[model samples]
Target: MNGEDAIRAVDSLFASVKNADIRQKLGKPHTNAGEILPAGVDSLINSIGDIDDQDIFLDVGCGLGNVLVQFALQTLVSKCYGIEVREEVLIHGLQLMDETPSLRDYCGKVAIVCAEASTIQLAFERPYLTSKRQGLSQ
Candidate 1:
């Protein structure tokens, strides 16, 4: 799908998850909780430029993991990580992935973690580790 189409699809998938009942349960305005719309995701991706399959995308304070889902759907990134401090929000994000059939393909690429972004330890290999290994071999 084209970029616009993809954004629309993402928006549609998020609509149910972002409904009033969910918002009321969360006890805050979606905007105040840092929920980003699909358009924002599109803009963010555009600003970040190209994403190769080797690249890993991380979204700090990822409200509902919609950004991670969008990146996984639109880019070739090998992995997408979303860090959310709120357990409730993270639960909803997981629900969105589990209940949406269309999101199944991209769900494998996305991971939503419930923890403070600053406290979480990502176990993925760092670029420096690869470079250091290369230097030692050379």
Candidate 2:
């Protein structure tokens, strides 16, 4: 499924969305998440402009998980994972993947974790980083 198939799929998924709220610590700035248009996602990935599928993608606050899904489905990355603290939002994303068999096909390659980012161990022992890929953030 190359071409603009992944983008079209994501656009379809978001078209059926509703409002959702996320909890934040008291007094802290209200954390707001924005939806990037499918074409914008394509442009962001295109800006990265990787020549090969060697990048490992990780979206810290992956609200609806469109970026990770698109990355994996579009063949832009070798592996993709999203860390979302909200269980309901994460469930909503998983349901999208379940409804679409093509997205489900990459279940092994895509992961969505419902947990606070603080709980995750970012300091990995493996050599996932390189001079070319200095950091993993999107």
The candidate that achieves the highest TM-score relative to the unseen native structure = 2
Taken over the whole model, the C-alpha lDDT of each candidate is 0.75, 0.72
TM-score of each: 0.76, 0.76
Report the C-alpha lDDT of model 2 over 26-133, residue by residue, as the tens digit: 776655476677777777777877635667788898877888877876765778889988777788777777787655766556788988898899666655545366
lDDT of 1 by residue, 1-138 (tens): 446876877887778763542353555544435467788888888887777787888888777788888898888888998887768877877887888897788778998777866676666655556532334542
Each prediction's number of clashing residue pairs:
0, 0
Q: With candidate 1 superimposed using the best TM-score fit, by how many Å does residue 60's alpha carbon deviate from the native? A: 1.0
Candidate 1 local distance difference test against the native: 0.75
CA deviation > 4 Å runs, candidate 2: 1-3, 20-29, 125-138
Give lDDT: candidate 2, residue 72: 77
